[model samples]
Target chain A: AQSVTQLDSQVPVFEEAPVELRCNYSSSVSVYLFWYVQYPNQGLQLLLKYLSGSTLVESINGFEAEFNKSQTSFHLRKPSVHISDTAEYFCAVSDARGGGSNYKLTFGKGTLLTVNP
Target chain B: DAGVTQSPTHLIKTRGQQVTLRCSPKSGHDTVSWYQQALGQGPQFIFQYYEEEERQRGNFPDRFSGHQFPNYSSELNVNALLLGDSALYLCASSLGGSGNTIYFGEGSWLTVV
Candidate 1:
């Protein structure tokens, strides 16, 4: 079975400040990790993904995450955030378990990031 | 092209009633997946349909059923809906395989009054 845990429910940062969102996962087998962002009343957009190869991956919008195998973590970070970055972020893991649903994703509770000017 | 489209953007039903939600996948997408998002929670995978067959299912009850047509469109049917079922139902479309990035729709909000 695979499960995701997001330690923070909400994070507030001033504009142009650095931000970090923590995520951890538990899976008996190899897994694929991802971070998604959902703006107000909008569908989710992919932030980044860690499938294989480099443990560190980045999104074009200046967000990056490192896939720590030993720690079972994929924490999202941005050196500087803008007010437009305020949104709900989700961390997910996929593994071969359960049936169809679980086989796709085991998402965390989601973290709300609020960037203030 | 539209990323993904769900019908009846918002619906209101009562307990013990039934509701059917519809979805049309993005162009070139062969797989459609359904998810349930309660207030302040991440989207929970409900099921996945591929090749007009149910290729995956979640921890939902039997009351939660679905269908897939040859055109790759899909519908989610819920019987004996409960108040707890009041939430946003999202439809996501991916490529022909499982565990893909999966693009999501704006979602259909179902309020059980």
Candidate 2:
């Protein structure tokens, strides 16, 4: 089975400060990794995904995540965050070999990112 | 195009009661999946519907059932609800084949008293 672990339950950072949300996964086979952001009472939005090609993937909002195969990590980073960046971040994994709901995602508990002013 | 949409944004039900949540997939999407998210926890897969049939199901009990319409809409029904069932029910839609992106709805909040 595949599983995702987010080391931080919560991260507090001031606006304009850099932040990193740590994520690690355990899976027997190759996997697709993703980061999602959820604001209060809203659905999750895809931040970025690591499918193929480059080991580093970036979102449009200046956030990026590097897929580290040896470390089994996909940590999300932002050079500088703003108040609008405050949300819950989730790390998820899906089997690279597709079949039925096996394509379904296994997500970590989530890290609440609070960008303070 | 409009994204995945779920109905009954919030509702409360008593134990032993039944509840149903509805979802309309995004335009051009043919597959629908349901998930249950407890407070402060990650969402858990419930099932997936494709071609108006159930393609996959998670470890949920028989009390959890679902249906898919020809129009690609779906419904999630839970019978004999328990307090543990209180959580946010999310509906996600995607294309049937490989490498498709799945989009989620805002979710329906179900509270079992």
Candidate 3:
């Protein structure tokens, strides 16, 4: 079985400050990584994903995550964040070998990012 | 294009009663997956449907069941609901392939008392 661990439960930072949300996973085989954001009373939106080729992936909202194979980590980072970035972020993983409709994702508990003015 | 959509945005039910939730997958998506999100917890996979068949399921009890229609829409039915069943039920859709991006709906909020 595969699982994701997000070390931070809550991270508070001032607006325009840089932040990093840590994530680690445990899997026997290679896996695809993804980051999702959820705002209050809304569904999740994909921030970015790391399927293959590039280890570093960026989202249009100035957020990025780097997939480190050996370390089993895909930490999300931003040089600066806006108040609109405040939300709960989740790290998820799925087996790279699992194809077709059999694919399923395992997600972390989630990290709440609060950007204050 | 419209994203995934779920019906009965909010519902209240009593224990031992049954409840049903509906979902319409995003355009161009063939696979629909259901998830349960408890308060303050990440979404937990319930099952996935493709070609009108269940392709994958999570560790849920028999009380939890689902169906997919020919149009790729899906429904989640819960029998003998427990207080613990009260949560946000999310529906997601994706292309039937490995490493494909999955889009989620706002979710149906169920309250079991």
Candidate 4:
């Protein structure tokens, strides 16, 4: 079984300010990490993922996250946020299946980011 | 080029009544997964269907069941629904059977009265 914990329920930041959303997970086996964003009443959109390359992975929209194994953390960060970035962000984990037929993701409660203009 | 789509964008049902939700996978996709999202909570996996067979399921009860058609579309049927069942139901699709990231639909909001 795998579980994800997002420490903050809400975060408020002014436009152009940096922000970091914390996420931690507990899993017995190797896992794949992912970040997803959900806009108002919309579906979840993939932000970035960490699957075993460099410890850090970045999204095209200037968001990035670092997977810290020792700390059991995968925190999402952005140097400066735009108003359009305001949304709910969720952290997910799927058990690593080197060769399996199906894999499902375990998600966090989500952090609501509010970027004030 | 169509993404995952769900029907009856919003629904209202009475307690103890049953409801059926539908989902259509993205074009060229063969796998479909369902999830339940409650207010202020993350989405919970319901099940996954591939090749018209149930491949994986979550911790939900037997009261919740589903089926997949030959067209790769799916449906979730909840029997004896309770107020707790009122939540956003999300459907996702992936290209292959597994190891691929799931893409989600806007979700259907079910309100139980």
DockQ scores for all the models shown? 0.49, 0.57, 0.63, 0.62
Candidate 1 vs candidate 2, TM-score winner: 2
- Candidate 3 residues B28-59, lDDT tens each? 89999999999999899999999999988999
**For residues A12-52, could you state the per-residue lDDT of candidate 3 as single tens digits?**
99999999999999999888888999999999999999988
List TM-score per model, in order.
0.95, 0.97, 0.98, 0.97
Docking band of candidate 1: medium
In model 4, what lDDT does residue B88 have?
A: 97
Prediction 3 TM-score vs. true: 0.98
Best candidate, DockQ-wise? Answer: 3
Comparing to the true complex, what docking class would candidate 4 get?
medium
Report the candidate with higher TM-score, 3 versus 4: 3
Model 1: residues >4 Å from true position, as ranges? A96-103, B98-100
Give the Cα error of residue A61 in candidate 4, in Å: 0.3
DockQ-based ranking: 3, 4, 2, 1
Ranking by lDDT: 3, 2, 4, 1
TM-score-based ranking, best first?
3, 2, 4, 1
Clashing pairs for predicted structure model 4, backbone only: none
Give the winner by DockQ: 1 or 4. 4
The DockQ value obtained for model 3 is 0.63
lDDT of 2 at A108: 96
